[model samples]
Target: MIGILGFVAVFAGGRWLGWAARWVWLLAWGWLLVLLLAHAPYMPPELGAFVGGEFRGWFVLGVLAALALAYRTGLRRLQGRVAPVVAEARPGAFSAVELDRYARHILLREIGGPGQKRLKAAKVLVVGAGGLGSPALLYLAASGVGVIGVIDGDAVEGSNLQRQIIHTDARIGMPKVFSADVAMKALNPFIEVRPYHRQLEEGFAAELVAEYDLVLDGTDNFDTRYLVNRVCAAAGKPLISAAITQWEGQISLYDPTHGGPCFECVFPVRPAPGMVPTCAEAGVAAPLPGVIGAMMAMEAVKHLTGAGQGLRGRLMIHDALYAETRVIGVKRRAGCAACGGG
Candidate 1:
C-alpha cells in the first residue's frame, strides 16, 4: 500500500506542477524502481515491510507499466502516419487538411491567411470549358476557389487532347463542362464545382452570370463573346476575357463598372464571317491557350484576393512564338453600346 501511494503521489505531483509528460512519467518510474529495490530480497526486512509490497509484485507492476507506455507510444506513431479526416468546416473557417494544403499561399506576403480565406469564400464562373478554360479552371481549383461554375455545350474531341489538359482521352465523348468538373474535383475536393452541360444562351445567361462574383469568357465565337460581355456589363460583374490563335493570345479584364472598358468598348464591330478564322480553321498552337489561360487564372486570383495589379483597363498580348509579351492601355468608350461607359 505504501509503494502504490508513493507512485500515485509522484505522478500526481508532477502533473500538478505542469511538468513535461516525459518527465512526469520518468519520475513515476523512479518511484516504482525505488519501491522495487526496497522490496528486493537483499534489502533489509524492515524496509521491505515499510514499502508494503513483495519484490515479485513490484517487479510485475513495473513490467506492466512499461508495456502500457510502449503500447501508447506505438499507437501514437501509427496515428501520426494516418491521414486526418477532412471534415466540412464551418462557413469562413478552414479545416486542418485545407490549411496544410494551402500552406504555401498562406505564407505569401500578398496572399496570406486573410487572402486565402477570401479565395475559399469566392465564387467564379468560367464561360467555356474549351482550350483556354481548361488551364484556367484547373488553376482556380488548385488555388482553392470556393465555388467554380463551368459551362460548355461541346463534347471533348480527340483534337482537344493536344492542348486541353483537363480532359482525358477516355473522356472524349463526355461533355466539356462535366469533364472539367471531374478534373477540378480531382484536383481539390474542398471546392464546389457546378457543371452546366449546355451552351450559354439568352434564356439563362443573365441569371447564370448573376450567381457568381466574377466571370471568365474563353469562348471562341464572336456571338458568345458579345453575349457574355453584354450580360456581364449589364450585371456590373468583372469579366476576364481571353483569346488564343496559332502563336499569339490576348487577355483583358473588362469591367466598365470599375473603370475598365467592356469588351464591346474595345472591339465595337464584330468581324465579318470568314474574316477571323476559328481554331478549327486556323489551327491554334498547343501551348498558346495554356499560356493565356494561366494568365486568366492568375488575374482571377489577383482579382478575388486583391493580391496584385490586375489587367483592368489593360490588354496583355503574348506572342509565344517570339517569346514577347506586351501590355497596352485601353479605356472605356463613352459611346459603347454594352456598358455605355457606365
Candidate 2:
C-alpha cells in the first residue's frame, strides 16, 4: 500500500508541477523499478518490507496504468475525428452560449444587443477564398454573421499558404471555397457557410448576388471582377471589393444604389493586359492581405450593424512597403458601364 501510494504521489506531484507526461511516466516507472529491485533476492528483507508491495502486484499496476493511458489516448483520437454538432439558436434570439460568446460585442456602445442581432440576421457573399478573402471570411465568421457564401474555382496550393492564412498545408489540394468553409465553421459553427466550389458564372451571378444582402469581391483577375461588379450593380447589392499586389492593397465599398461609386465608376477602363500584373507575377507581401482583408471585414461589420462610417464613396489604399495609408473620395460616373450614376 505504501509503495502504491508513493508511486501515485510521485506521478501526481510531477504532473501538478507541469512536468511533461512522458517525464511523469518515467518517474512512476522508476519508482516501480526501485520497488522491484528492493524485492530482489539479494536485497535486505527490511527494504522489501518497507517498500510494502510484491513485485507481481507492482507489475500488474503498471500494466493497468499503461492500458488506461492507451484507452484515454484512443478515446481522444476518436473524439477528435467526430464532428461536433452545435445547437442552432432560435430565429431572432440568441442562445445562452451565443450570448456569452458575444458578450464583449454586446457590451459595446455601437454594436450593442440590437447591432449584434442585426449581424446575426445579415447575409454576406465572398467572391474569392484567396489572400484577401481568407482573412475577410474568417473575421466575418468570427463576428457571428448569420450566413456567409464563398465562391471560388481554385484549389489550395502550397504557394498560397504564405498570404492565404486561412488554409493549412494539409488542405493544399482542397478547393479554396471548401477550405474556407471548413475554416469558417471551425472558427464559429453558429454561422451558416455556403461553399460554391465553382467559378462565378454570368448565368448565375445575378441570381446568386440577389440572395445575399452584400457582396465582397477579392478575386485577382479582371474578367471576374467586372462580372461580379456588374451583377452586384444590377442586383443593387453593396460590394466591398479589395485588391492586393506587391506591397500595396486597396479596398472600397461600391454601392451606387446607396449614393456611392460602383467599381466601374471609380475605374471605368480595365487596365491593359500585362500593364497590371497579378500577385503571381508581382509577388505580394505576406501580411498585406491580412491587413486589407481584416479591414474589409471591419467595413462589412460596420455596414451591416450601422456601427460607424463605411467605405462607401471612398477608396482606401494601403502601401505596406512604406507603411502608409490613404483614403480618397470617389464619385459616381455619369455614363458608367456597370452602374450609370444612379
Best by TM-score: 2
Residue 50 alpha-carbon offset, candidate 2, angstroms: 32
> Cα lDDT for residue 208, model 1?
97
The residue-by-residue lDDT of candidate 2 on 77-167, one tens digit each, is 9999999777653468898899998898999999999999999999999999999999999999989999999999999999999989999
Which lDDT values do the candidates have, in the order given? Answer: 0.92, 0.92
Worst 10 residues of 2 by lDDT: 84-93
| Alpha-carbon lDDT of model 2 | 0.92
Query: For model 1, how does the per-residue alpha-carbon lDDT over 45-137 read when each residue is reduced to its tens digit?
Result: 999898897989888888998899899999999999999875342358788889999999999999999999999889999989999999999
User: Which window of 10 residues has the lowest lDDT sum in candidate 1?
Assistant: 84-93
TM, every model: 0.74, 0.77
